[model samples]
Target: MTDTTKPRIVITYCTQCQWLLRAGWMAQELLSTFGADIGEVALVPGTGGVFQIDCNDVVIWERQRDDGFPDVKTLKQRVRDQLEPGRDLGHIDRA
Candidate 1:
């Protein structure tokens, strides 16, 4: 079970675009980096070329608005920033 008190991450991807693998991979990456720091990483299916990542209820990454996908480092940084603004992700912060 997830801790509701912690932050939730939602990755919504376009099902029609076959972005499941991409979304799943991103979820895995977030989980790997955040571990128990995060509440849960959910893979939500969507359409219309949507690929977005949300931390809590805030939209962190939107494909259309951001103009394409984020690299793993940027994703991590964004998530870390949202969850804990002052928290340093070691190498991630440096890189």
Candidate 2:
């Protein structure tokens, strides 16, 4: 699938180490929900709680961090917005 563009999503957490795990969980959920391929996890040591999610050459959604864990609602919205167009993830077959 060299030519094929898989769905790529980046999940970020707050500078605090705790958010790393939390963000990872959210990223996993999104991966399972959309069955997207090419899932990516990025951690920003210094930033304003921002995470980026890129979906199959369709859209790039950024997630803002809060004091507590990230809300799933925001994630769902971003995914929906990106997948709305005909991006075609090609295949989400990953173990």
Model 1: lowest-lDDT 10 consecutive positions: 86-95
Give candidate 2's total backbone clashes.
Answer: 0
Model 2, position 87: C-alpha lDDT score: 43
RMSD of each: 0.8, 7.3
Q: Which predicted model would earn the best TM-score?
A: 1
Q: Residue-wise lDDT of candidate 1 within 1-95, one digit each (tens)?
A: 88999999999999999999999999999999899998899999999999999998999999999999999999999998888889888888783
TM per candidate comes to 0.95, 0.51
Alpha-carbon shift of residue 69 in model 2 (angstroms) = 5.8
For candidate 1, list the clashing residue pairs, or say none.
Answer: none
Instruction: Please state the error at residue 64 of candidate 2 in Å.
Output: 5.5
> Model 2, stretches more than 4 Å misplaced?
1-4, 15-17, 36-70, 85-95
